[model samples]
Target chain A: MNAPTSIKEFFESGYRQFLPHVSIDCAIFGFHDNQLKVLLLKMKNVEGWCLPGGFIQWAEPANEAAQRILQERTGISQVFLQQYYTFGEPERNKEPNLKDLIDSLNIEPAEDNWLFRRTISIGYYALVEFSKVTPTVDLLSDECCWWDMHELPKLLFDHDLMIGQALQTLRMQLNFHPVGYNLLPEKFTMPELQKLYETILDRPLDRRNFQKKMLSLRILERMDERKSVGPHKSPYYYRFDKNKYDQALQAGILLGF
Target chain B: MNAPTSIKEFFESGYRQFLPHVSIDCAIFGFHDNQLKVLLLKMKNVEGWCLPGGFIQWAEPANEAAQRILQERTGISQVFLQQYYTFGEPERNKEPNLKDLIDSLNIEPAEDNWLFRRTISIGYYALVEFSKVTPTVDLLSDECCWWDMHELPKLLFDHDLMIGQALQTLRMQLNFHPVGYNLLPEKFTMPELQKLYETILDRPLDRRNFQKKMLSLRILERMDERKSVGPHKSPYYYRFDKNKYDQALQAGILLGF
Candidate 1:
């Protein structure tokens, strides 16, 4: 027999009883086609929708586990995954289907009952461009998609709360940090950037005033060419200058809220 | 022999096994007398100081647990306690004495081992007026005091990190929301407000420019009386108007970073 010496064994010795009880749910946000979207997955065995989530192993840091989940579900690495909120409502996951799955796992009946009774979840939000990735479903889910936020279908458990929290956190984050660069693609137009903010805040923003206000922040670097979208004066494309963006961040200029 | 139902009952079921293992720590922030102060507690068994923390019963929301902790440990209730960070470094609580306390409670030996090895903590920050609060020790602490931000004694676990994150968050929050009103008394002089910002930001702001900038926001209802705090020229006192404050929040005034 091998000695339980590594981090996996080291944590298992202490936290084995709580194995697979806590999980990380991610509201993976993406901006594409001038609309804001979130990555979602359908339940593997049931007709329910959920934010991308995975069980936290005993040895993993919550954040590292979230990042690992991102990699396992989508072939992307080092994206901006922020821990936004933690869901701790009692009896959050006591559904009959979920309980049936626990029984199938052959976990101690009493212990599983206890663990399943009050599952607290740590919520995270990630930003990535929709066109730059492929979805890879883990063993837990059947399919994945970048569902438009306004057109979202019904979600399971407290996922609706998670999404609402993510939106709130995004607006709050924007109050201090410019995100379109990290959240959007490299050569996005001004309208595309503005739409992302408007969608998140769930309100209409005056185009002229919004552009003037954002431009004055001096975080964006205007590119030499315009996006060839349509007949209506295609706006100049812009990319966030790291130098300018960092300076603005230092000045607390993220608010387009 | 009683059924553990609802949230209150849910907490009663596993409170014994969960109480001593999971702790919620708070970064209690108070700005008063023109200096930024944080609440720190003297460790029960050790000479070192630490942030105010207490164990979470299984049934409590992390926020509810934080509120209970803030109230029990500091006798303050319904203050502005907000979750800011979570520290989950595997070796976070590696104290042997702590491990013994956990084991003595009749939890799994592995639970104590896991707690010492995998003790994860959620950090919440509360906003308050320091002059109003008097710290009192609970079962886990011996003494408590409001420690100045500039001069701090050695602390336990990842408390310093929690403080740094709180301060960083506070500074950022100030850029979006006016904070001195809640942190100070109902009516305060402009200079007092200025000094509070300066002390926390650690930057000297121009008096003439700062006054003009603050008055423009229209959040303050300038009062007729002047406070004679110093032997120098007394400044006019201003009280925050709630209507103007809410209006300003809705308008999203550009508070220059």
Candidate 2:
């Protein structure tokens, strides 16, 4: 999609009918090369970055809006999306560089300028396999790509704080929820699962203890398949036993530290 | 405080400057009489109960609004409050009884009637000691009291769904976070703590397993004093070691299932 032809036409023909101060921003997390990555959008005609986001329709549920934005930005659908937090501070819209970015865009300041108004955004996070995501840039952004979580650039409008909170929520959910499977291949070895957890938890876990904990959950099925990566010996592959996984989800699991 | 004498006067004198279409509702949970209870408001001139909730100030954060409303309704402050979920279905205002109640209130149907408009409320859940609360009725409600969770009255709007989600969130948090203390006295016996867990989890736990799990956390300090409440023998009382509890909270704890 091309950039808006002009500021006036953008307002008249754009998201005018959408909810004015409500939006949904997504932290689409993916695991690649044993490292956690987050999808970010590079703003058009500006040097700042932000999460891929969109305004919610007046009649749309917030959760549906999140899924729609996730698919529109990354071409990934039906993934594990969760609404984790809402960022609604009074001064979130008054960030200095953001104001400058709006000014540079040549968008005239008007009371009806929904783009510049204070927005209370609902934050939704998704976990998808890195190989499935094909990032697409929309009219408002120049590029969309994954950034290393540890080497992220300065993001606009409290997005950095949003990412921080999202990461915290993801980490907390990892202990009890069956989330690591979403970031991995359909079939993976135990070691690969361990690395995913280590990357998300940001710590080294005892391999045996981790294996025992995972195995005891009875949610993984040992497949009659093996794959060798690098010079390491072939490790047995496993996939989630969907029946057992769903049962455990319904009953809930508690993994200890 | 008394109920508003007239609908016009109510609109002119109350919450006019707050943000439209956004509010905060709190499920203030209390443990009493060996059962879990939720504080609910009996709507005035209506046959429905609802969670104590209020509008968010345009300048205030949603979290602060929840705290303010919680304190206003229950006279409890500085309690454990968490933003568990946000309810934003498009047809939430179309609930039959709620619509009828609004219609019977005899307020003029205006586009700006905040009470009758579609609202997306952020749901917050608070855990407060039952004894410390002094429930107060507000202008919108004729009565405010604690209702047993097992036997809640038919609530207005989608409040019943909100409460169920809040309970699920609380039950999940119980496994990892130290939250039972917020519902108990400064010094509590092992059975008291166990009973609280049973109430939250809504199931019986093995006595030895529960005791072992709790004691292994090292957050409790045995108190010097003990009391006998009935024919049962004196059970040892324990108080949380605040320093240790805070440290565990910072480092994070994962209690196994």
Candidate 3:
């Protein structure tokens, strides 16, 4: 009820007392076995899944909120998270008002309140290798699972739209850069890389042509041949030369292929 | 203030008040000469010295909100506006709280409850042509002008950050796509296009290579030679072929030398 008299005062004014204001959610995706998987958190109150999201703190950089949240949930802190879009549709939530939020967050469920009752959330998408991740069942959510993208269940709120935008960005990235390395484990075979891309683009690429085009980028470092993994003689496994990868990336090797 | 018991009543409960939000100000840029210029506005208070910005309507799409704001400021419609970053550092505004807004908006000074009091703005940048645009000042803002990128004034709020991000996006776009046609006036010489990119990226490009790359894109239709505009016979002014440009774009032409 007091006036914010200065710059610091203005930023901190009634800030602790808002509906946690704005929040950032990461649509973390990774590729494995030719299947794209997204990390989903199953909440306790509702029989629905949601993105690993957390409130944007005043002290932290607005953009870095998602990365902090990612580290908090999965213990993966070194990866880069690019924010491609913001979702601010007024009717995004399912609750009649802020009642559901009050019950979930343990705040009083009052319709007349302005602070915690309404908020505009921003979405950030990040790509990571699922094989390296260790999912956590945080006390906040009932379960955390890496569900195959093709088999996603009903998501909570506007999360479905966020996922869709992330997919679109993923496809765009593939068409512009060689991104499978970041989405797959190191020393991945040609088939593994191609499958990851196929799942991303949702199209079948000619094996011969895909291999030729990918090799033409001249960034792949041929690892010492390949070892037996399955039925057929395993194809040559390769890891992109880090320095060469950065160079081609600078030259516009969009991750989409 | 009212309480709602049902979904329909929730919307009609008079509790669905519009949140006081900031208008995303976009300075759609166009390249001409060796000078980089962006389409801007002249506001009522400052007059002819602002960027096109509008509030996020309660029932509007976020993208549509930006498009509407652009149309309202410039007579041109359907310009590409992409969100580059948000400017939410509390110290961004120099205005003395709501008083400055009240003075410019012609509202009663005592109307402290006005929605403009709490606005956290997001900035988006667009690519546009200066010549084709007829700057139409928004009713809220007065006067419109095209200011040189290097000569930008002490802009209000975190507009400086917005301008910086726009320049970054411009550089990235130039490297990713052949962008002269949309940003330049019709019947422009190759040199003009080159200069535009140089100014935007703030770096020098090899003239011969730049021309060869642009010519190969086949987006520009060589008109009946270049018309002499000023000193030096303008090296054949060329207009962009919309269909060809779009076709090349759709087919994904390479943007490299």
DockQ (Cα-based) for each candidate: 0.31, 0.59, 0.23
Tell me the deviation in Å of residue B125 in model 3.
1.4
Name the better of 1 and 2 by lDDT: 2
TM-score of chain B of 1: 0.80
All candidates in order of DockQ, best leading? 2, 1, 3
Q: lDDT per residue, candidate 3, A135-226, as tens digits?
A: 87554577898999999988888888899988987677665566765676778888877887788889899999888888988888888878
Chain A TM-scores of all predicted models: 0.79, 0.89, 0.81
- Give the clashing pairs for model 1: A177-A254
- lDDT string for model 1 (B88-165, tens) is 665566643454333344444434343343556777888887766779875445689999899989887778888999
Q: Give the per-residue lDDT of model 3 (tens digit) for B68-162.
A: 77876666777767776666554454443434434655445333342323355667887777767777765444567788888885565556667
**Per-model TM-score of chain B:** 0.80, 0.89, 0.74
Model 2 lDDT, full chain set: 0.81
CAPRI verdict (incorrect, acceptable, medium, high) for model 3: incorrect
**Stretches > 4 Å off in candidate 2:** A1-16, A96-100, A103-105, A180-182, A228-232, A249-251, B1-16, B97-106, B229-232
Q: Cα deviation of A224 in candidate 3 (Å)?
A: 4.4
Clashing pairs in 2: none
